[model samples]
Target: MLAASLAAGGFTADPAQLESPLGYFALYGDCTRLGNVLAALEQLWALRRHDINVKKHPAWYFTQRTADAALRLAERERLDPAEVRSIRVTMEPGGWIR
Candidate 1:
């Protein structure tokens, strides 16, 4: 729906529809309703703020630095593939998991 909306080339939209569950999810399954999707995106863009400051928390900072160090070590050492044994990665307790 969003891709179709972009192709239609219009900025106007029905606020009521844009706010509804059906509209937000494109559950109506109609090409004609794409205008509302485009309008919602436009409104989001217009309301966006550039002053936001994002700070990486301790766990994130450590995890990113660890990865960077690992990459640098690999490039500097140039270890042979056959000699490498095993690798393990550990993170802070609350870090992301999959």
Candidate 2:
């Protein structure tokens, strides 16, 4: 499901983290992990020239920036909306460069 959703373009990963009663510590911890993953993905792809569209994916304070970046990348790649099945994110929210 995750693969399918990623393949599709412009799907929202709304409500990134903090939407649930998961507590502050856990939320921030999860945000860190999400940031790490996003950084690694960006590095892997040389998104130096890609054009990305951002639509304001929702996020708690912890994951806002990273979520925004992810959305941007997803737009830049022009992911196949039909193929997208899932996204890794918190219930609360939503980037890119190249």
Candidate 3:
């Protein structure tokens, strides 16, 4: 709960289907800097992942990255430098943080 600030991804889906082979991906955290975001995207590219697609809208771009079975996780943004950290969690259908 110590995150600098919190924001939800616009991408929505059934929690049950989130773990599918091609799932929608949404990037969270301090996105004030485009370079850091691009670098993070580059890292995934280096992972031999071919589903990386940069869309017109960033939300759609990341969420659309997941196909059917995609990895779902949470991202934390630091107060300084706007660095982001990814956190893994199990989410239930219709479950969310308010």
Candidate 4:
């Protein structure tokens, strides 16, 4: 719901989303290590009619290879920069930390 609202331009993302390293990592992690987070994000993206600039709004979770990709997307899209979600053990070494 929150992610949708942000994408729709209805809500400004929390500055903390961008500022907090923990929050940043929490939302956008590797799907391989965090499949559930990725899946939920995919579903959220699918809910909206507009095209989410995958470049602008990144997967949030990124691998070493995708670090630059995430940064570029953050600069361009700035979507849900502060939105946080609860954890559901969707990934290993997990619990929710956002």
* The candidate that achieves the highest TM-score relative to the unseen native structure: 1
RMSD of 2: 17.1
lDDT of 3 by residue, 1-98 (tens): 22223325344446634333343332334433556546766774543464444554333323343421232222232233234464353555534433
TM-score: model 2 vs. ground truth: 0.27
Worst 10 residues of 1 by lDDT: 50-59
Ranking by TM-score: 1, 2, 4, 3
Candidate 4 local distance difference test against the native = 0.50
- lDDT (Cα atoms) of all candidates against the true structure: 0.59, 0.55, 0.41, 0.50
lDDT of 4 by residue, 1-98 (tens): 56776789866667666335566545554333345545656775553533444443333443323455555666787747576253222343432234
Query: Runs in model 3 with CA error above 4 Å?
Result: 1-27, 45-98
lDDT of 2 by residue, 1-98 (tens): 56557759666554644334474425544434556545644764434333333345443345566667776877999888688898775443322221
lDDT at 73, model 2: 78
Residue 11 of model 1, lDDT score: 58
| lDDT value, candidate 3, whole model | 0.41
Task: Please list the residue runs of candidate 4 whose C-alpha ends up more than 4 Å from where it truly belongs after superposition.
Answer: 1-62, 84-98
Q: How many steric overlaps are in each model, in order?
A: 0, 32, 11, 4
In candidate 1, which residue pairs get closer than 3 Å at backbone N, Cα or C atoms, i.e. clash? Answer: none
Better of 1 and 4 by lDDT: 1
- Candidate 2 Cα deviation (angstroms), residue 37: 41
For model 4, give the 10-residue run with minimal summed lDDT.
87-96
Residues 15-87 of candidate 1: C-alpha lDDT, one tens digit per residue: 7574455664455433245675466546644434423234443345547767676667787999675777987
